[model samples]
Target: MAARVGLNGQAPRCDHIDLLPAVEPGLPECKECLALGQAWTLLLVCLTCGWVACSDDSPGGHAREHYRETDHPVVAALAPETAWRWCYVHGRIV
Candidate 1:
């Protein structure tokens, strides 16, 4: 499905995105990935409780693991300007 984009690639049509809490500031790195000597391409931050985990594409896929263990629901990209958030329950990026 094609998403509506505004002046800055905004997609207000994604109402679920509004319900997701913003990622807490800080948490610059995936502590587990670092400790395990694994490199991550992307990061997911738990909205319910601030926990940073590696993305599914990463070696360990800790982000998805976190959802499985905690069912926290949403996670926003760690990088600025990405403007992407995923809802595990819904299985889509909003």
Candidate 2:
């Protein structure tokens, strides 16, 4: 999907981007799902602390849960070739 752009034709900036960890904490899979013996459809990396969790489409909405509990505002897809980020507060891709 095309990113949402601002009046300047640039992708809209998310304030939470500042919260992204200096070192990306992305994982190949959701450790939470692995520990629970559950299958996950997609993986997301919390930009704030590098918490890896399953996407909302999975059995456990762990990524959303992490945001709910910690108020971490951003996440990025952990899958290969996917370069996009989501801002929970804006409810949109950033």
Candidate 3:
């Protein structure tokens, strides 16, 4: 795999990519999605601190919230069949 680089051009280590189980280990099922009954098409993974949150503009804004609360450094687009991570601190696509 030719590591995908983020904006900063630094390639993130693929070893950090974690495969979440069907039932997420620690994340709470999106309540906003449940209340509005909307299903999320994509999930956001925080590479800076390894936090997983819903995408921006969602009811929870979990991803953004994570950034706000934790100040984690990076986040990447999480997909079932993909392995890639993004670093927020360096503004790179590693």
Q: Candidate 1 — what's its lDDT?
A: 0.77
Error of 2 at 38 (Å): 1.1
Assess the local accuracy of residue 40 in candidate 3 as a C-alpha lDDT between 0 and 100. Answer: 65
Off by over 4 Å in 1: 1-23
Number of the candidate with higher TM-score, 1 or 2: 2
Task: Give the TM-score comparing model 1 with the true structure, all chains together.
Answer: 0.72
Off by over 4 Å in 3: 1-38, 48-50, 57-60
Best by TM-score: 2
lDDT of 3 by residue, 23-47 (tens): 3323534444666677665567766
Q: What pairs collide in candidate 2?
A: none
Question: lDDT tens digits, residues 1-94, model 2?
Answer: 6555665676576657765666577667887888999999988988788889999999998999999999999988986588888898999887
Per-candidate TM equals 0.72, 0.78, 0.48
Counted clashes in each candidate structure:
0, 0, 12
- State the lDDT of candidate 1 residue by residue for 7-54, as single tens digits: 457543544556666546557688888999989998877776778889
Which pairs clash (backbone N, Cα, C closer than 3 Å) in model 1?
none
The lDDT, on a scale of 0 to 1, for candidate 3 is 0.57
